[model samples]
Target: MTDDLIGKQIGGYAILGLIGRGGMAAVYRAHQVSMNRSVAVKVLPRQFIDDLTYMQRFNREVQIAAQLEHRSIVPVHDYGESDGQPYIVMRYMAGGSVDDMLNAGPLRLDQIVQICAQIAPALDYAHGKSVLHRDLKPSNILLDDIGDAYLTDFGIARILGEAPGSTITTDGAVGTPSYMSPEQAQGHPLDHRTDIYALGVSLFEMATARRPFEGDTPYGVAVMHVTTPPPSPRLYNESIPVSVEQVILKALNKRREDRYDSAAALAAALRTAVEAPQASPPPDPQPSAPPPIEIQPLAERPIPAPVYPAPSAPSLRQVPPASVPKRKRRPFRLNLWVGAMIGGVLGCALLTVVVGIGLLIVGTSTSEVGPGETPTATADVTPSAHARALVNETAAAVESATPRTPTRRATAITNTPVERSGPSGTVIFFAQRPITVDGAPVEAYNLYSL
Candidate 1:
């Protein structure tokens, strides 16, 4: 049916929306009016309704699909023809299909195997019923919300015991090209092995996110199925074990005899590979010298006669000898010279600290010096900055004065006068004399009191 039947109600089932549409039929999400339960109703497309070949095939699919009663196979509740359109109603799967999962990227090995395991049994059941599903790809495998895998679309399946040339349509290729088995690609008679091969392609795509034989055209891919060997799935994903790859490759063999006998056989192999204990390969042999073995001369070695100890001898408890006491070592000798040097350094540091403290006290103490008693001025007075400049200038003048007497030395004691010019600031000084101390040598020193 076209999109018109989407909102239309049929036989107590209200068509809610269209989930998907294909070449032969369109699947719609509908609500069962009687039970108010939601289900997916697959009706033949409007374009294929008038085609007798397609109608017969669609009706046969419903009958065959209804026969499959496995958990992984979608359950067919009812089938009927309304307004000359044949439809098959099936249980709705909320989780969509494997094709949706593959749209993003390849799934992990465990996930692929798990999905495959569920679908494999369904295929095995249908194959036992002599129904060969021509289209067994990711899109045809539905996953429910509970992680259950369901096989769908028996529309193009070939019911066994029927004439080989009596298929619905024989002019063109029947199933999806990317997932077709070698026999299907060659347009030869197909068996359950064909389904196994298709399932292998599906598993390969799940593991690699791409088909085994991909081409720009369908014809080119069909040619690959007949000619080329598919690359190992592990090449795309290194996480896949070699055993898994072997199983996938065995199923994907170009020849029917090379593939597994049935989907059950393939599923068993996969389960074994998944559950079987992994074994490490044998190590390579190494060439080396043999070990040296000791040998004794029989003539030189004496054989000892067996001797038994007396049974009456009783063992006595013995005390262990006392442990030897550890001796004390003498203390290290201290060097007197080093001690003296250290003491001298410490004494010097103390003296310097004491002198600094005394100088600080002398500078700060006002009562230590008699303030009323002014010190008498003496000839040996402290040198001021001005006086120092005068002394330098006088030295230069004296040197110039005695230019002819270079060898003679002159010593003079006099007050050097200094006259300086500044920015309107008068230079004044309070003069003071330096008095001789008892132990200090007489010398000119600065007196801050001035």
Candidate 2:
């Protein structure tokens, strides 16, 4: 299949080269002409296209993957069949798989936390959407350029709404032995917690650089998953904190009830354990001391009092005469005078303000009526009528004295000429003319404009 697909065009994607090969499918780096970008294309073998079971699983992978939209989940870009073969197009992850990273060496504690934090939420999202990643393992988890983990390859995932025994195979179990939970290994009904167990195994390997259980055969490994209890991660690396070990153990529990209810819950516990401070060792015990003596011998003789010579009197030159402080009579008189002056000034200012206000009112009232116009009101009319008469006279005088210019309708100049000096020459450009008032363009005068 890899040899035939190297130069073949599938759907709208032009196969550029092969990226990796798997048991069921071959991944290739393809150029999507529509998007003008590179993408990873997983092509299933042509033989499986005729098998209803394999076809259904391939379709399920497409449907389930298309629904999951998350930063930590590899996005499905396109899926279709071509030349009697099914293939799925996904984002190309440049950092390879987590399994590849583990092959080199064990991940650091910080790296483990970072990967789990991303993976847990992705599982939670899938579970919330009623999908289960039945075959979760390190290989299924891919990383990006910056080390962000993304869960991929949901080929064997079981939808929660499917009927019972729908996913059971003739051989019974369906997932990888080393990463399968007890329920999964025993062919029992699975749920989101099973994925949590698998994640636990992946995390254990990440922290300890080895799996918790190992066997000579796949069957033996599957059996150990159901029967054997996970060893403490600290056993592999004593530097692992105790809190982290407890978290891993809890996730690896045989019974789903004993484990975290959701992947998010497990992730929270992992983060807390990794970030928590290690417990300090107990202090060494102090030596026991004897009880104090109850009785002590009295002193043989009474202590004598020590005497010292008296201090000599200070000389007359050193002694300052005690003069009575003089009463500050001038300050008291000055404060009274200052207060009186301030009071007078304030009174004068108040009077000036009041006179100014009164003059302003008189001027405004007188100006309301022109000199030639006399406001006369009937005896039955109220003061409001008189004020209305004065307002009418003022408006009439204003209209008569002001010159009436010819009313010109504003015309929208769509292309007004604008000139600016540029490096090449004076650039003449056309723009929409702005609204103007009395031949003056409206200028922005607000604080923001200034």
Candidate 3:
């Protein structure tokens, strides 16, 4: 991990040479014996190897960082300890860091956009995993031989929901003061936006070739970040568009809340502003109405009455009218009166049968000529013509069966079913002189019947 490890072997990786050394860790180009591929090896400094608390946290954070799999993020190959030192192996990027590029010359606007495009989404992906790259700067963005960029050094990033460890100490400021967010400078609680603010500072530096705020010491610089507003990037680079300047300032806003919510958003804003600097400002919050049309006043131009189309003259049909369908004739049916007559004939036959049956029943009975025998009627029970006619008329009424009106009639003087309670005796009356009943006339009657 130190300078002496140039020719030494640590955990099957042969240290080729030191790549760079930051405050947290030292990166070295190493040869992987098992895979036979060149890889970048990042080792923890010896100063932190003795601190057991930091060692445990470092391993935990690196393990989480290894789980990240993204095209833009530098993929972790392996991580383990050699003796008392922990080291992480990752893809070896050949094309130096943006730090080197900046040191050589000012970056082109398109180059800055291209680099941001690659890293912004990677930062957002880390944030989604609740891992914040507390240290996001030019030095951490690695480029390849072809100028393609990738985000690296994620092993030193702090987990969002966890407490501050030795990697990002809570007692003092966390990241480099040049790119540190205002909240990070003040040692305040941080969220994903802290990384966004640092990105803005980096953007300012890339555009202007200088940090937004500088002081005599790191503490002084951090305080300046907290207290002072960042000078415009255009102040150093007059060629920078105002829209691009606005995006940087917005990301570098003193309040974390005022910054972009996601790294992707910041990159997109920068891309849009830089690409379309001459484009019109965004439309107002309210919906845009159509351009107004001018109309002449009614006083100067009198309203013309609407003219209606003239009606065409009536004309005869071009073709003769289709012939109306003729109504079909129905077959003949029996008249209702004929049905009534047939019904009447049937009813008369039924009545004649009934009358004949009654007469036959009467004729069949023997006349005993006394009460001990039978009702010896002196007259024969013959079906008389008049009686037959009356029965036929009564049978006619059976068709409709309508109720009849009340009529008075004389009661026959024989065989009334009277209730007899006491003694029954015969009473004979001769011309109003024999027996008196009800204190009036003369009549013969059974006493019980009376």
> For candidate 3, lDDT tens digit of each residue in 354-430?
45644544444433234575443334434456545544454454423422223312233443333322212211111
User: What tens digits encode model 2's per-residue C-alpha lDDT throughout 1-450?
Assistant: 238877879999999887777757788989999999889999988767777777777787887888889888999988888877889999988889988898887899899988999999999999999888888888889988788999999888878877765653323577788899999999887888999999999999998789999989999999999998888788888988878888888889999998889888878887877776454211234576798866544665556699897998877677668999998754212244554564465446534643453454355546676778765422441224434444345434433433323432244544443443322121222233343333433211100000
Question: Clashes in model 3: which pairs?
Answer: none
Q: How well does each candidate superpose onto the true structure, as a TM-score?
A: 0.60, 0.59, 0.59
Find the candidate with the highest lDDT and give its number.
2
After best superposition, candidate 2 residue 156: deviation in angstroms? Answer: 0.8
Task: Decide which is better by lDDT, 1 or 2.
Answer: 2
Model 3 scores a C-alpha lDDT of 0.73
Task: Quote the RMSD, in angstroms, for model 3.
Answer: 26.6
Q: How high is the lDDT of residue 40 in model 3?
A: 94
Instruction: Please estimate how well model 1 matches the true structure, expressed as its whole-model Cα lDDT.
Output: 0.73
How much lDDT does each candidate structure score? 0.73, 0.74, 0.73
Off by over 4 Å in 2: 165-171, 278-450
Q: What is candidate 1's lDDT per residue for 26-55, written digit by digit as tens? A: 889999988788899998877788888888
**Candidate 2 whole-model C-alpha lDDT, 0 to 1:** 0.74
Local error of candidate 2 at residue 90 (angstroms):
0.8
